[model samples]
Target chain A: MKHQFGDRRRLLQLSIAAIGFASASLALFIFMVTGTALIVVWVGVPVVVETVVKVRWLAELHRRRVGELLGEPIESPYLRRTEGNLLDQVRGLLRDPATWRDTVWLIANGTLGLALACVAVCEAVLDLLFWWLPPGLAMRAYARLSRALLAPSEKSRLALRVEQLTESRAETVDTQAAELRRIERDLHDGAQARLVALGMNLALAEDELARNPGAAKALLSEAREASSNALAELRDLVRGIHPPVLADRGLVGAVQALSLVGPVPVEVHSDLIGRLPAPVESAAYFAVAEGLANAIKHSGAHHMSITLSLENDLLSMVVRDDGTGGADPSRGTGLRGIARRLSAFDGALEVSSPPGGPTELAMVLPCASSLPKTLPSYGTA
Target chain B: MRVVLAEDLALLRDGLIRLLEANDCEVVEAVDNGPSLLRALTTHRPDIAVVDVRLPPTFTDEGLRAAIEARAQVKGLPVLVLSQYVEQLYARELLADRSGGVGYLLKDRVFNVAQFIDAVRQVAAGGTAMDPEVVAQLLTRRSGDKPLASLTPREREVLEAMAEGRSNAAIATRMFVTEKAVSKHTNSIFSKLDLPPSEDDNRRVLAVLAYLNG
Candidate 1:
């Protein structure tokens, strides 16, 4: 009985989505005609191009909606022309089949779309007016028609998948290179510098030891200090590479331990039932740590809170800070690293820090494995 | 005078024993692993224990764990934990009970023979001797604090020195300032940081640390 009602509700949603597209397409058609007519003045250049982009965006939404109604995935088929001159872009849009399909969709939506919506609404009213009237058959027919027009072919779906894989692969390579540079810079500035000083001090101490034992003691102490500091730097470097604490305490405890080191107070609330895959746990840990570090360093924030929970296959974490807001991905800082860090896991992050207030960052990772991993006999201490 | 030492590395362990003996402190027992350290602690009931952060039988925080466990068994048992890299989290864990007789210092501090001996003796006498790095970590927690902003740069340096459990004379000598001048700055810091007038330096340091941790 619930499934039947759910189907009915889905049918209603499908009809409403179609109606929304139909109205939007009518306005879009009006704008396109004006945009083309005013092309001689070049005032419509932006307008026409923007409409073209808007249509593609609208088709993506439509495809996603139709796919949701079908309870499956629907991939966008447009080979996105993210680079080109303006003339080439316009030509490219005109040359694309998806653009012409959008035009056909607009025209069809303008005519049959309006008729179908009116009939669907009137049928509901008539059903209320009468006793035994069901609109399932008509709604199902409309869904089928929309699907036939919008769904991508098998070959195009494969193409879309390949494009996505290639882009992510390229990004992974770039991220790796950037990370190596960062590690190299850290070593040069930290342990390497300290070791050089330590080596020099040891050499000088050797010379002074035989003649001036008193001064030699001071020099030896300084050298010892340098070596220990170098060791400290290497320890920190190792921790950053992979925190042994994470292995001992798991994600929740590791995060708690980590936040204790933040300059500002951090409250972490995590509700996860079982362990995530080791790689996923590590990725999520660094992502949250980076968010906290940024808040402490740049945000000028007083207090921060991190909350993690699992919803279905996704583990979601939100880190919020009270600070001088304005966290932009385009600007410098480790904000961009969060994306690169999670991209490997098919995870995504969103930052919302408008100027002059609180910054809230949300990260979500799809986890297919929620079974708690068995503890290794020896996980550090 | 008596101490139990736990360190994994043979060379460092030997060096530390020589350093302690030279400083006139007796080594009651020395162990390289966590279990032996625990057994030694119980058997000797030494005046204090100096444990490394990472030890054998896991090599990750085993020494710290053993020290905490030993302290639990022996109330206010002075334990000065040495780590290659000191973390504020571990420092807080050591100080969490709000009981004295705890010192968490970076192993680098051992190079300064006089200061390291002073810290060991201080911890043995039931006074805390936090590493300068740990103190720096605490000071950073209150960065941009409105009250902290009122302090002069010199006064901030004085506070850093004080948080490392240094006496006014030691701070004065180190900063190249007179004792009277150091005292005046401490008075100002106490008022500006709004620390209640405390006579002893250890209580003052703890008060300042607690305030910073806030």
Candidate 2:
């Protein structure tokens, strides 16, 4: 009997605190009104942004208070944002569905939400004075009201997913364009120039054949050397585009071949039974390659290992090295480039490197089962 | 030596045929696609099969596959694979049987005609003739192996030459050392790698390659 009285006293105190929070809702209502009214003018953008920011803070406070009354924490539904310029920040705020929801929440809480708090206080007093009403019923109703207005709807979740896809697609296209330009530059300066020189050397050798046999021999040798150099450059360029070994062998075999070239020995483990999609394979291969290169260049340690596995349609790759373990993706373009490459395939890269020890880089890509190739059906060309 | 050649490009095929004939090797048959090459290999049973890595009908490692398949049927069948590029994976696959009659070289090696013919002859005699590039890659791969780490830098060089199927005299010529020094390095390498002494150069190469591929 005494415990029941103590619970009602605590409920009465919480109801009073809930009524106190209602006063901030009126301030939010005024800000929304002022911000919306001034949005037509040029100076209204910053005001509206500030208004949204305050609304988020107030909504967070309401979520906390309501969550406490309901006995569970409410998750904030706002999308994460990086630092941007004023205009971009404003645009981001306007683009977010959560901001609009917050505005609606502010309006609802100012009117009906305030009334619920008042009714809860009246009920708490009436029940406390003479056990005539159930305790905390109005407060429970207020918590449900806040939750319905504040939680992320399904449409908002879909919008967030679309925004992420748009970002990654734009980045992938930009990276591809840059890669094409680099390839063009490499051909222009490396193989194409070498071939032109080889042709000129051959023509000179022909001219000097009758007049100067020794000069002709020297020119012929130069032509041969030039042709060899051109071939070497083209081989490198082709490897950069898509390694021939990768075409012949799958990802594991290709990575095995790649491991043979670097100074450090890499032990590879795999549970992949068959091939993945070509683009997924390529992306994963390059990401692992980048990891190996980074380990060799930066990690002063001696050993490295690569492991690949496929489980439940998710392909996972992990590259680990025992070296000085301070790797920052933002500081180096290699890791950033890997992240960008993976994002195109809806893959993700994760780095875990504590100071003074081993470093591990993990990546995951969702892919389907291997498709069987029609090798025997291919006839002679 | 009798040879069966498979190359997709007509111009290179003619040049290779002419080069082989001039060097006193008989071209028993020459074909373009993977299936025809397989048929030619089975029919002629040539002393050596000079195959390109990329052939027609698939254009992706068709010739290498056919060569490997033929070797599987006719055990220890000599095959010299040429490719625009070299891959350690293909080298390992060709050597996986631990058979001595295998040669893998870059197409650029053909520009050095004398060395190229020497490799072809060596392979036909049931000896391995790996490209120096592939040898370098194998050496890099085994850098962390404990016994290889015990070798001196000169010994490592000698080991690389040996893995490329070089005779002690050839290694001496290449390294500007006497045959005696090359032999000393080879003996030390064999002892360090724990291989039994052998007189046959092909067996010696097979042992060295088997150790590296291990």
Candidate 3:
């Protein structure tokens, strides 16, 4: 009970302090605006500065109070300009929105805070002094009045809690639905669409074959091209969902698969003889693929080297190239997407590309003990 | 001519067999994977084998391995490996053996029916056929060499086309020139690179491959 009383007292004190500071600042502001030059220089300036400082202190106190109430640790933003020169300090003071708004709040809250403080003090004193009064005369009357004032507020609080829970659940359901829609769209637009077009082309070619041999030949050629294209597109779509090679042959084989598709010569070096976690392998594979794609398309590189190693319980990768080097991560979405993907696994990506030289991309992921039990054997066999 | 086809896709495998049969070549065996391809090669001993780059269990480099293994087994049996995409690594791996009668081409090349059939026939006859895209990649990779720097633009084109295993006639058609002019350019390219002048030999292809792989 004593602890509860002490908390209430602290809250009241902070409220009063905030109000007093705001009131003083507001009065000073009005005085300065009205061309009261003498008062502005003598009292208004100092009062404004003091009010600003006190309001900031109060805001920090309030943040701590709220954190304590919620049982969480939260740090507050505070002014820490101790080393600046006088002019810089003045400029900072003038530039900060907190300085002006807080000063206004302080000046305005002074009168309101004084009245609330007096009323609270009087109520506390009366309640304590009248402890011995008959329950029906004092305590019962006070409880009735307080209940009347807080009943509607208690009902609204319950309603707000229900609304918050419903909102959160709705958000979760919406996110899942969006993901499902995305997957469906990928299938429809990618592989299925191409297969349908291929079938149509084949039908047209078959019809034309009995009518005219020359036209049939052309149509047959188009059909063949469509079938080949559809095959390639379907292969890519299937690979996107889950590469069978990655599952069957593991990360090394997956990287080798990518290396087999690159236009430039890629030398793959790996000290990782074992398999990694599925997510880790996927992240690493995509990172290497995107890096290689960028290097080939934009770097104008002739030769590239990819190295994957396990160092100190971390899977690390480095892709380096000898090209016309100026690679900027900010200019491309590929690197940014890679960074986001790596962040999901608590991995780190670093790039070093100086102008007119070699570009290197390095990534490290923590997957020491989480590797798969058995490593698949893969070779040119 | 006799041929063995190995492709993982059932539709493509069947279509290719029909096409080969229609072209009057005997397809002795049709298998779906690299291991089966090797098995069929040993059992049938077909005159030529057409393989795909990606095959069963793991579709990475199984076909390339099968081709290399078949070459090792048969000594000089012709092999043609088709791929949807071209990679310099695979080309280097195939050319690394340096034996005669090998072909690496993009699968789309089959759309040009006459040309693709000719390529198959050429490889079966102890000759080489490579895709122009693969040859272009090889040339770009080798552009930094001092020896390659001496060739003129037209000579370079001729060299690249030759690396694709195009005969003088095909080279003439592609370059929009007469066969005599292509022959003259080929001769100049050989002499400029200090290669032996073997007119009867298909030395242009050999010269381009040497420059690209070297």
Query: Of the candidates shown, which would achieve the greatest TM-score relative to the real structure?
Result: 2
The sequence of per-residue lDDT tens digits that candidate 1 reaches over residues A42-102 is 8877788899899778878877776776677665667667568777788777755666667
Q: Model 1, B1-214: lDDT tens per residue? A: 9999999899999999999999898998889999899889988999989999888887778898888888888887889999877777777778776566788888878877899999888788777778887776666565555677788989888877766767778889999999999989988877886776655544554654664465
Top DockQ model: 2
My TM-score estimates for the predictions, one after another, are: 0.71, 0.87, 0.60
C-alpha RMSD of each candidate structure in angstroms: 8.4, 4.5, 15.8
Candidate 2, A225-341: lDDT as tens digits = 888898989998999998887776768889988887777778899988766767777888999999999888898868899999998878999999999999999898888988888
| lDDT (CA) per prediction | 0.78, 0.83, 0.69
TM-score of 3: 0.60
Compose the digit string of candidate 3's lDDT tens values, residues B1-214: 9999999999999989988898979999888888899889878888899999888756676887888898888887788989876555566667666665778898878877888899898788767888877675454454456567788999888888777778889899998999999989988888877778664334654675666554
Q: Mind listing the fnat for each candidate?
A: 0.55, 0.68, 0.13
Candidate 3's residue-wise lDDT over A1-381, tens digit each?
Answer: 566555555544544443443345446455434423433455544444544455566645544543443456334333343346544554566655445544443443344433544454454445445544321222222223322321224334454455555655565466457757876887688667867877787788788878887887777677677676766675556666556557545678778767755668788998888767666787788888888888998888889999999987788889999998888878778777566556655677888999986999898887747555343434422
Shift of residue B58 alpha carbon in model 2, Å: 3.1
Question: How big an interface RMSD has model 2?
Answer: 3.4
Total backbone clashes of candidate 3, pairs 3 or more residues apart or in separate chains: 11
By TM-score, the candidates rank as 2, 1, 3
